[model samples]
Target: MKKTIQRPVVPPASVSTPVVSPIYPSVVYASDDPDGLDAQYEGGAAGYTYAREGHPNADLLARRIDALEGCSGGIVLGSGMAAVAAVLLGLCGAGDHVVGGNQLYGRSLRLMAEDLPRLGIATTLADPTDMAAVEAALRPETRLVLIEVVSNPTLRVADIEGIARLCRDRGVLLAVDNTFTTPLAVRPFALGADIVLHSVTKLLAGHSDVTLGWVAARDPDLAVRMRVFAVTTGMTPSPFDCWLAERGLATFALRFDAAQRNAAALADWLAGQAGVRRVLYPTRADHPDHNRAAALLGGQGCNMVSFEVAGGRKAANALARAADGVAFAPTLGDVGTTLSHAASSSHRALSPEARAAIGITEGFFRVSVGLEPLDALKTTFAAGLAAARDA
Candidate 1:
């Protein structure tokens, strides 16, 4: 009070600034713009100008992801491939080259090998765990390096921080697909990734009901470019899809936590059983990248676990057919335990040689642990293992 008495009056503009919410409060649509202009073009509009550009639900989901990623901004896309395409197109042009992981999601590998080249972009696949291979694969025209936080079928954890350092020194953008680990286990941006992509159809959504994707960038400018690409390409999710994704996200942390615990237990039990050759859970000490996974993924790995059956594809098929509670499905990260044969399901798109090179064996069976009773899952797998041995 005494100080105020002696102080001179400050101008209204200089007094204080009002706080604005980081995320928009309510769902808005292109039609909601007062001027009736397209949502993206309305200069003074408080909400979305167009459905293709962005809606309130998408914006909110993006904001939530941005917060989880520790990034400046984010964009939601219609599918995981759309998010991947947006980043790749936004960052590189026709003459630029990309160095990507050899053991990536099958669709991503196909995109890099088949589609990007046709668009005049070149890509080289390298073992992300091999620093020498990565460094050697980097071309003078390389503008970006892409990798997965965890390999889909193999569960090999890439050295994200090491790769980030290499990219920073080379002045290249680092894009990481964080679909498997999700933000609950791994925050790729915080580990130095320039951009993080998520297939929200998986862990982020928790349930198998929704199909969505997102990309988050540490640099604000990059995010703007990605957003522009998304808008121009019309790779946007509907407002209803966004709402469903948001609902899925609300229980993601809880579901992932339980699923991961079940995965670890199953992995341990599987390792001790007959007819199981190898287990590929990141947290397991025998994993090649276990140390790196522990350092980056908060000690606890993800809900994905891959194992090798002793009898190759025949044994795998037998095991898949004999499994009791867990469904034999291609997709992952659902509430119910799911099993898939990588050689036939997720990696069917890859050439046999390419699949083998990435360690996707004929006997490989990938399991997505769910929030199921661990004891029951163990009993189910035990029975399947015995059946496979007999078969």
Candidate 2:
């Protein structure tokens, strides 16, 4: 047999393990014991029975996220919205109430505002900026209170510590969306957040190629329920997406540093520009939530910036079209700098007056600053603003 063989049949496994976590795309896991499978499903044990219930990629990613978020356990969902749905459905049911702010990511607001009520889960949208408003909205049935660390579009910074304290005193679960501010800036867990959620589609994935979400909980029981809800909902994240997200996690420090530095520069420049009406950046002393943002975020702004262009929608559109070396991306946290109109994109579902109330005006736009050089970004943005002003 050895004489007849011309070459080695199987490639040898590396002596050292691969740096990247291997992608486990297996949908089903085989086990000889039927009872073992039942046990694995009944209690989230060590082995995986199925992808929907649990998979290696999702499990590994969840563990890493749990460590990052400083939580007891974690779960991954197919999309950010899936995570939102699972949190709402897993934690609350008929007759339960949720208190959230109006300044959340539009989809999150919509989910709490429009969808939860039909499911008999009552929701109250309050002003997260006002602790009094947030406290007043809480009801006897309130199960959870949700708020974003950095409110979408308007960039309003929430007082996570105050909100968490309020929720704790009331015996309500405090869930904060840590999408905009990764653990690098601040850990919600440190501030007493009961649950932390992230749309891994943005910064966690970094490349904008993966659409995934994560939820971390301080309570192991709640984590188990969320995992079960994820399985039942059939929103198991793809293994490939999980692997990519894991890869993105490695370079996050580099990417985030560049984007944050660039964003601060751009925000400062926009504030001085004649065509700019207002710059809503935490770094600026003039921002509505500057003090809160400073106290929480260590005197630095986030990777995102929102500003009002002089010409309203017409000029904003013109600026988007006229801008060079950038794109009008509807989403954020890409390696390349991109812009989006808050009115027509993130908050499009809301009525005009409702949008205005949240400071999402027609001229308002968001910039997810990328790894571009500060000087180069300023030149291109200055030209675009001038073009928008002329338009």
Candidate 3:
């Protein structure tokens, strides 16, 4: 009975391999040869000995992400913000400067504006869609330039190719957050971006059940550096979460296509509605970055839509209440359509003036379009708009 406690059930090795990736929940691994463990620790052998240093689940997911982004290597982190932190802290040290877009996600904005400053790293916020602004923000000490493929809620697309070129000429690393568009819409690495980041908890996972993120680098050395930082800081993701995200990723393409179709329909419907003050979709002709998005994304729109209502918070609340079955959650990228109020949700950390400076307002709402019946969603939006008008 005591011996049983020291040993667990073991399955016989079979010729057949698993169709799905098996989760390796072990915290420690044993090697037949004592020198084999030393070899792994010294990077002479290709194997994992500790969960914190490396794990099979993380390695597999990282490889899959690398393949999708067409990059040499990448690393998986515990959360989306962890990926961002790893890149900044690993690549840029004290006295280094980083240039980022002004329209970044709120938490990202805080990380740059507040967190990095504490570490002696300086950050410059610029409009990523404007080449002039990005180029002007670059300083001699600038080490990294970060931008989102698309501005959150506002749906403004950035000029990745142009920025990549500018960063290259200045010997600066360009990191593009590909969460909104994903690899399906655009591959930043192919466009010459040095680094690509993703909030896998969103679109990549396709479902909101797991929290995961990754940073892929065109340069293999940078990928290794990021992974080393993640491991050192104990930012590793759980094997079970990685397994869940991989499962979600398996159906990502199909789910994304269906959600995109519904989003386009919703955008069209909102454009014709009386209460809708504005509609923001990349593919829409009236969008500020319409032509650029068309050229970059090849005429395919993403699964996100944002629109402004006529009134302020009152109108937004009424609309949310009227929309039956759709949740008004702060997060996005679920199989079911959901709504998020920009001022109260994503940009809540910002002051009213700061939020207004970036186009976020009381009446602004972002929709995470999902795999739902187009007609049914339209009906819900129509009712919501009517309710807003009455409010």
Candidate 4:
């Protein structure tokens, strides 16, 4: 048969395969038989017709995520917030209510509190660490309750098992954001979470390169529904991004372990520093939720630390400026150490009173500890502390 301009020849299958999975960037896939393509579209046969609906890279990554999360199925989306939106919009309808932790990622809080309400989906925010607060916020109309395994900026660990039990008793679906404490540390599904969400842009991807997210469910029906919603709403992630994320995920355990070690050392160092007022790490004995974090996270502190400088915003800025080799990037889970000013970056959406109530003062800085050597990070932080003292 003569191949035309529209029809390209495909190479024959080889006996030997490449070690790395080949990236399939083609947006449209072709089949020789029209009936075959029709069957694929009809869901009777397995094939990729379009990138948005399904693709090799995404499917491969999703399967791996499902295995890791110990779930029946999972779906990958464009970004962390995209996964959040899918869960909210897919299962929820107008007049539905949602209860979320106040300590959730600022963007998540805004999405539920401000944006969803516009669609007649009311939201209630409460302390995730307190079971009473979580239960109190739930309404009969509440469809879902969302909380983070470990909150952003503040690093307060939630009672996943307790919250999960409460949600189950109330017949509300529970979604837990496991971004901070990845599956390497804690698996939310095992603790009874109905849906597990991840900002793969963080620890799962390990490197700060890709912006991706995923939602995993043990229920096949919920997983299928989420997949449909993601496809229809165009929350599709790039194939190249998925490829890159898979590459990063390969070394996640190593990177996460090293980062955790660095964080522990950094926390200990900061506690003894003159200008450091306080340090918040899950495993730290001084932390308020230390016992809960230890029980839930298996004594693994994960790779994040939030500390307060003695002075306020001015001191924090000076510390960030003087911190040698540490970038003041707002993002986390990088190969290199970086700092984020909570009030200015992560929690900027909240009002001054709201932020203050959460203990995100101007001097508060959250560190995404990386795979840097303990000694090296200590030196960099020492410089920052000195700057903070001088300021």
Pairs of residues at least 3 apart in sequence or in different chains that clash in candidate 1:
39-49, 39-50
Query: How do the predictions measure up, each by TM-score?
Result: 0.89, 0.94, 0.97, 0.97
For residues 1-391, what per-residue lDDT tens digits would candidate 2 score against the true structure?
3566344233477689777788887787776588877777666556877788778898788887788887757888999878887788889999999998789888888898788999999999999888889999999999998889998988999988888889999999999989899988889999999889999999888998999999988888888898888888898899999999998898998898889988988888889998888998888889898888889999768799989977777898789888888889789989998898878888888999999888888899999999988888898888889899899
Computed on alpha carbons, the lDDT of every model, listed in order, comes to 0.84, 0.87, 0.90, 0.90
Clashing pairs in 4: none
* lDDT (Cα, 0-100) at 146 in candidate 1: 92
Ranking under lDDT, best-scoring first?
3, 4, 2, 1
Candidate 2 wrongly placed segments (more than 4 Å): 1-15
Arranged by TM-score with the best first, the candidates are 4, 3, 2, 1
TM-score of 4: 0.97
Report how far residue 223 has shifted in candidate 1, in Å: 1.6
Model 4: per-residue Cα lDDT at residue 262? 88
Each model's total of backbone clashes = 2, 0, 0, 0
Scored by Cα lDDT, where does model 4 land?
0.90
Runs with alpha carbons beyond 4 Å of true place in candidate 1: 1-42
Residue-level lDDT tens digits of model 4 in 53-114: 98899888887777778876789999999999988888788999999998999999889878
